[model samples]
Target: MDDTLREDQKLTVRAVLAREGRGFAEEIGLGRTNNPASLFGLLVTAVLVAPRGESSGPARAAHEVTNRWHTPADLAAASAQDVAKELGAAVEGVDRGDGDDSASDTAATLVALASAVSETWGGDLRGLREKAGHDPARERELLTALPGVDDGVVDVYFREVQPLWDEVAPFAGTRALRAAAALGLGESAEDLARYGNRPEKIGRLAGALARIDVEGSHDEVRRTAG
Candidate 1:
């Protein structure tokens, strides 16, 4: 948490990354985003790992199903093994992969995730959003009730939708915090995101920061460690 950012460079990075983050957000077309569905995608993607990482793991694990599942009801009705197969395909193509038979866990977790979403949120992700009432803490509480969504995934989902929720500088995982730290942005990506006029842009910025380390731009992050 030491502020290693030099005064001269700090202004430059802050301005540059902030602008870049907003542009990136626009490129991703999050300007007029739909609620619940987009948030659900974030939740699913977070289950596997970094969605923006170089590997296609996120695609196989979640993105492959995002367009397919569309809602908790969609996933809940599908066979659990079919849901698991998407992740199975994605993980197989990656390196230094997870050791366990995550496919099985993926199946069970996906089933449970979809079931919880269906029963609790009534298959409308917006219900949870409505219940959150713009409070990030409340949002986190609701998200944690889902099967696969933990603190990390909750942060991911909320931050991706932060443009609507009006929360500043959200991070998906600790690696992102460290990634920002390496760039002299400080240990807390949230704080750096707050420096920008549009804080939601930090969600994308956090992803970029975390990806740098995953691609070996910095020391490797032990992502699987709890």
Candidate 2:
């Protein structure tokens, strides 16, 4: 974002960003809209992507689910079986597993999550934020309590929504931090963010770093940067 950066460092970042400059939320069409519905979509994506080996399948499932359900109330109204069908269709060739119950189980958990959100927060995730009092640790604890949400989900959610949710801005989880260190971008989220020169850009940088890690493109990115 400034001329102070070494040319190689800027090139390395640009190479990675060219592949995926947007956070997962934005990649999935949720675009920093922090409304209840967009929050629901973010939650859906986090839940789907957590613990997954590759992102494509989970991303597809999330896209299908969010495209169908605009709100927690909408998702809560749907049958778990219908949601299962959607999930199954979304990842038809992804080989998440041959297990027949996988999609069904995920559907059940998601439906329960939607119901909990609708009942507890009156279909608004902002209430959860208010309850957390803008504390990241408290927010993580509360998110982990949601049905089907785990630490991995919380990490993904935090990374993707940091731009929109100032309460957790500039956050980089384990994957992003690891990628940053590997790319000579420093060991901390703040260090990685410093390259962007804007707080919101941290989410984009973090997401791009995570992608490099997941896709095993460290050498390629480094070469491009050089």
Candidate 3:
């Protein structure tokens, strides 16, 4: 993209993110004062906890683990079986889909993310958090180290947590893609990325798309295309 176009896209993305962030914060009853680590843990929990039609049992469990362990590394140190057992206990009434896969995946991601932060960046996540401020590439790399976490997950993590780190223009994810399509931005994830990863633009697009109550809305359909 040209410099001018890139700048415009970024502005759009920022507008979208701001809107989405506000909605998400309100949904979860979180205040703006929460830090990145806190938000990261919360988001990760959201992933494990909130699949379609599911309540937030996994999120609550993950939060408890985070409170007790203090860091991903601390959680990572536990045996997979132990982690699964703990998570299962925490998410008591909810069916976690499979016996151990969910817990194992969560533990693996946490450990790998922690390890990547220490080995690749020469610091714990706390130290490497600065990468989001200085280098988006490094931030993406660090995020991808977590098992089962794809571009979508990474984008979500960055978008939600970036504000806590005092960073701007964190990447957009599926929600952003849907939003952009609603705003007539573009059709694919590639197109959205090309538009810049500003939160507000992405958030606005998503919110508009999500608000479509009509059946057969293109924005709603686009969400299932991937």
Candidate 4:
């Protein structure tokens, strides 16, 4: 929608995608296909997985949870407390200290959001998909109705899922922001999202940002790259 990205921004995104595409594809078992649902799931899982630090354990745990319960309906049917407890149990060997609580919180939030989605949209992702046709505003409103889905989750969902449904503006986040900052394109996800317009641009931006190691601040990346 917005054609604001520069040539450098496009190159940065392309570079990142090239670096991380294989790993991400393998990690998510999507192979070479760029299906919207799978992409959406990966991004959503990333949010829940908490890539802030020591993500391998949490990422594995999140994958396990998704495999055990694939759809929003599966999550909606779960007991929040029980789901939390189950996630806490699942992460036992991988995580330490209060990590279990974080897992529990993530589980609870996911389940609650799923339940809300089910109640609002007939227990199917299609409901949201349908809304995308008539009114994006309503679609977003429905998406935000889920308890754990904040603006951050919404952004990820829209960007990753829209490709599956139809072309739309890219929704950037911390990952993209970090990448943009790394490339000297912008300082934050919001800026990058506003800048990226085309699908190629979005893909490239996401790819580049995904390559950055998720340690230290954007400034640290700049200093290290120098």
Best by lDDT: 2
Per-residue lDDT of 41 in model 3: 62
Per-residue C-alpha lDDT of model 4 across residues 178-215, encoded as one tens digit per residue: 65665676775446555455543554455446446454
User: Which regions in candidate 3 have their CA more than 4 angstroms from the true location?
Assistant: 1-36, 39-43, 46-58, 89-99, 118-123, 129-133, 183-226
lDDT of model 4, residue 198:
54
- Global Cα lDDT for candidate 3: 0.49
Pairs that collide, model 2: 12-225
Models sorted by lDDT, best on top: 2, 1, 4, 3
**Residue range 74-150, candidate 3, lDDT tens digits:** 65565665555556645645344456665666656556654554466443444555756657677666566655455
Global lDDT of each candidate? 0.59, 0.80, 0.49, 0.53
Stronger candidate by TM-score (2 vs 3):
2
Between prediction 1 and prediction 3, the one with superior lDDT is: 1
What is candidate 1's lDDT per residue for 74-162, written digit by digit as tens? Answer: 88888866666655556644332344455666767777888888898887677887888856778788888878777766655555666
User: What is the Cα-based lDDT of residue 93 in candidate 3?
Assistant: 51
Off by over 4 Å in 2: 2-4, 92-99
Error of 2 at 195 (Å): 1.6
Tens-digit per-residue lDDT, 103-178, candidate 2: 7788888899999999998998889989999898998998888899988788888877776678787788888888
**Is 1 or 2 the stronger prediction by TM-score?**
2
Q: Pick the candidate with the highest TM-score.
A: 2
Give the per-residue Cα lDDT of candidate 3 at 120.
61
| TM-score, model 4 to reference | 0.63
Could you tell me how far off, in angstroms, the CA of residue 173 lies in candidate 3 after the best superposition? 2.2
